[model samples]
Target chain A: MCTVCGCGEGDTKLEGQSIHQLPPHAFIRGAGGHHHHAHTHSHAPGMTQARMVQIEQDILGKNNQYAARNRQWFADRAILALNLVSSPGSGKTTLLTETLTRLQGNVPMAVVEGDQQTSNDADRIRATGVPALQINTGKGCHLDAHMVGHALESLPIDNGGILFIENVGNLVCPAAFDLGEAHKVVILSVTEGEDKPIKYPDMFHAANLMILNKIDLLPYLRFDVAKCEEYARRVNPNIQILHVSATSGEGMEGWLNWLQQQRP
Target chain B: MHEMSLCEGVLQVLEDEAKRQNFTKVKSVWLEIGTMSGVEIEAMRFCFDAVVGNSLADGAKLEIIEIPAEAWCLNCAQSVAVKQRFDACPVCGSYQLQVIRGDEMRIKELEVE
Candidate 1:
C-alpha cells in the first residue's frame, strides 16, 4: 500500500469505495429526437443534447487544490519557492549554477530539477554542495504541484530556505500548472530571436520576472537586446527584466541581489 | 505534449462519473482552453485521440473553445479584453492591472451515453 495516502493495490479496502458520483441533473435525457437546449444547440444522432447542457465542472480544480495545500506548507516553513520556465538551451541551468554559487552558505538553498529524461541539472546543483532533488518527468512536458509536493517531502525543509524548481525546458506547457511557487521566472537567452517574447507571449505574460541570459555571447550573435526587452515589456509590462551573463559573471550582481532580497 | 496527461485527467473524471451514474460510453467532450493557459489546441486534439483509444471515451469527439486573456484595470476601474495579462489598459494606458480571468484550461462537460 502507498503509505502516504493508503492508496495503492495493497489498500484494496479503501479503493473499493468509488469516488466518482454523478450530479443530480446528470440524467434527464429527452424522450424525443429533437432535444433542443439553449446552451448546447448541437445534437448527436442518438445522444440527447439536453444532457450536455449544464455541466458545471472544473477540470483543473483538483490540481489547484493540491497546489493550495503545497502553498500553505511552503508558507509554514517560510520557504521562498520559485518556478523557472523557459525553452531548451535557454541557459536556465547556467543561471541557476551561478545563482547557487553566489548564494551558497549565505542562505540555505534546495533545488528540484525537472527534465524529461536525465538528472543532469540536479547533478550540477549537487556539485554546488546544496541539497538537490531530481524529478525525471519522462516525456511529461510540465511539473504539476503534486510532483513538487513529492519532491518537497524528500528535500531538507530548513527554515528560511529557498527552493528553486527548474521546470522542464519548454516555454508553452509549463506555464499552465502552478508548482506552489512564490514567483514564476522565465529565462530568455540572447541567442534566441528577439521575437521570442512576442511569439510565445503566454509564457512571458505568465512570468513575474524575466532573465535575459547569455549576454556574454552578444558580440558573437546578432541578437538585439533592446528589441528583446521591448517585446517582453509589451507582453508584460509589470515583469522585472534583468540581463545577466552566467559565463563572464557580467550583470550577475543585480540578479543575485534580487534573489537575496526574496529570501525571508 | 502535456495533452496526454490532461486527457488522462479527463478520463479519470469520466470514469468516476460513469461509475456513479451507470453510464457506459462517452460521446463528446467540451474543453475550454485559455489563451494564457499555455496549451496547444492541436497537440491536445492529437493526444486526445491517442489517449482515449481504449477507454470509455474511445471515439469521443473533443471540442476546444479558446478563451481570450482578460484583466481588470485598476486605473480605469473596468474590465477589458487583453492579449496578455501585463499589457496596459487599452483606454487608460495604465500599468496597474489585475488579471481577473483567462488562465484556465478545463473540461467543461462530457456527453455520455
Candidate 2:
C-alpha cells in the first residue's frame, strides 16, 4: 500500500482498474473531479494535494516543563546557576578550571561537566577541591534539563553557591534546549573566526554573556578582536563581552569580579 | 545525535495518543520544525526511521513542515518574517522586537489507521 498518505483503497478509477491499482496521484482532478473547474488540481489513486493539518503537540513541551521545575528548584534554594556553551577547543574547560581554582574555598561551588564520552573535565575540576559531577552523554550532543536535574541531585552544593553546567561542546544543538540556568554564557576563542557570531547567531543571541577567551594568543594569530566584539554586539547588543586569557591570567580578575557579584 | 532523543520523545507521545484513541497503526506523522529551533530536518528523518523500529510508529511516513521566523516589531506594531531574532524592523530601524513565532518544534498531526 502507499505510505505517504492513507488514501489508496477508494472508489476512484484510473486507466482501467480502480484507483488503488494505479500509483498515487496519477490523474489530475479538477475542483469537482470532472472537467472545467475554477481550480485545476492533481490527484492520484492515494494522493491529494490537500494538506492534512490539525493535531498540535509541542515536541519540546515536555523538556520545557522539566526545565521550569528545575528553575523553580534553583530559585527556591537561591543558587546562582550558569549554563556554559561553546564550540570544541574554545577553552571552556581551561577557563572553568581557572575560575574554580581562584574561587575555591572562598565560595561553595559545584560543577556539572557534560561530554560525549569522558570524565576528564570533571577530573580537572575535582582537582580544585570542589564538588563535580561527570555526565557522559554517550552519543548525545547536548545536555537537557532532565540530565541537569539528575546531576544537581548527585553533586553536594551548599546553600547559596555557584552551579556551573558545562554543556556539551556544540554551538547549535545546545542552544535549542534550556538547562534551567540563570544565565547562558557563550565562550569563544580568538582562534575561531569572527564570523562565528554571525554564522551561529542563535547561540550568541540566546546567551546573556559572551566571553572571548585566549587573548594572550592574539599577538600570534591574525584574529581581529574588534571585529569579533562588533559582530557579537550586532547580534545581541545587550550581551556583555569579556576578554580573558586562561593561560596567562591576564583577564581573570574581571571574570572573578563578575562571579563574586553573582553570589547571594 | 540529539535527534534520536527527539524521535524517542515523538514515539512516546504517539503511544500515548494511540492508547487514548485506540488506534492500531500510525499511517503518517506531520511535524513542524521552527527555523530558530536548531534541529536539522534530515537528521530528524533519519533518527525517526531508526528509533521507530519495532514501535507503534513503525513504517510510518514522516512529513516535515518548516515554519518561518516571525518577529513582532515594537516600532511598527506589526509582525514580520525575519532571519534572526536581533534583526531590525524592516519598516523602521528599531532593535526592540519580540519573537512571536519560529521557535517551536512540534508534531502537528498523525494519520492513523
Candidate 3:
C-alpha cells in the first residue's frame, strides 16, 4: 500500500471503481525525483504578499481516514481485529502460533503478517492450518491501516472471526500508525528491559494490553515483572498486563478468554 | 524512515490545500511538531526535501515550530515542562504526570501563490 498516504498499495478496485485512490504525493514522486526551487519564473519581486492559508491540519489526517474506514469494516462484520506490536523477536509470532494452535477448533481466525522482507512468518502461520497473508513492507517500518484494509479483502475471515494483523517488529514506528484494530497488543519478553514501557512510552501508551511473554524463561532471567508492570501502568494506567509463556502454554486460557470477551 | 512517510503526509496536505485554495504553487509551509510527538526534527527535515521533491510543495521552505513537551503532575496539581515522556514531575518528582500538550503534529499555515 502507499504507506505514506495510507492508500491501497496496488491498483485496488472494488467492482469497477478504484478504492482509496492514490494520494497526491504519489504523483509527486511519480513525475520526478528532484526538488524544483526555481520559483523565480513567477517572482513578482520582494515577497509578493504570498497568501497565507490557515490550514491547521494534522499530518496523519489521511491515515486516520483510512483507519476509520477499516474500523467500520471490522465493526460491520463483528470481526475482532487486533494489531500485535512489539520490538523485534518479542515472541509475537510464537504467541500467535500457539494461540492459533490451541483455538483452532474453538474459533475462526486469519492473520496478516507484516515483515520488512519475507513470507517466512506467514508460512509459519499457515503451518498451523489457518489462512495467513504476508505483507512485505520492503523499507517500510510499520504496517499502516491502508495495507491491512487491502489484506482484509483477500483474507477469508467472516463475521465473528478474529483477524490478527501482526505489525512489523518495531516498537517506535508502529505506535503512530493505527491499523483499525479493536486493540493493540504489545508483547514484551522477559529478556527485554523492564523499563521498556518508559523508554518507549508512545507504544505502551497506544497499546490496550501488554503481554509479558516468555515467563518460562523468567527463572533464568533477571527481568522484574512487578517493576515492568509498574512502569507500564505509569505510562498507561489502564493497560492490562498478561504474563504468558507461549513455550509452556501458561496463561493461554486467559488470553483465549480475553479474546472471547471481545467478540461481538 | 517513518519521517519519510511523515514528509509525504505534509506534501499530501499541501496538495489538497492547493486545490481548495486554487494555488498553483507552494512557497513555504509552517509545521508545529511537539517534542513528545516522537518525531525527530533532524530526520523529518532530511526526508522533507526528497518527499516533496516532485510534489506541489517542491522546493517549498519548511519552517518547523517546535513545541515543548508539557505534562500535568497529578501530585503537584500543575502543568510542568517535560524534556521527555518518562520525566519525573519537576515539582513533586512523581511519575503521576499526564501529558497536556506538545504531542501534536500539525500544519499551522502555508504560504502559497
Q: Please report the candidate that would top TM-score against the real structure.
A: 3
TM-score of 1: 0.77
Ranking by DockQ: 3, 1, 2
Which 10-residue window of candidate 3 chain B scores lowest in summed lDDT? B49-58
Candidate 3 iRMSD, 1 decimal: 2.7
Per-residue CA lDDT of candidate 1, range B52-87, in tens? 665666667898888887888878999988776546
- Residue A41's lDDT in candidate 1: 56
Residue A251, model 2: Cα distance from true site in angstroms: 2.7
Clashing pairs in 1: none
Candidate 2 chain A: 10-residue stretch with minimal lDDT: A24-33
TM-score of each: 0.77, 0.79, 0.89
lDDT for B17 (candidate 2): 79
Q: Write the per-residue lDDT of candidate 3 for residues B9-99, one digit (tens) a residue.
A: 7887887888888887788889999988999999998788767776667788889999998998889899999987768888878888889
Give one digit per residue, the lDDT tens place, for model 2 in A19-84: 234442211122232222233355576743434435698776656776888898888888889999
Q: What is the TM-score of chain A alone in each candidate?
A: 0.81, 0.78, 0.86
- For residue A240, give model 2's deviation from the true position in Å: 1.7
Which residue pairs collide in model 2, if any? Answer: A25-A44, A26-A44
Against the reference, the lDDT scores of all candidates come to 0.75, 0.77, 0.84
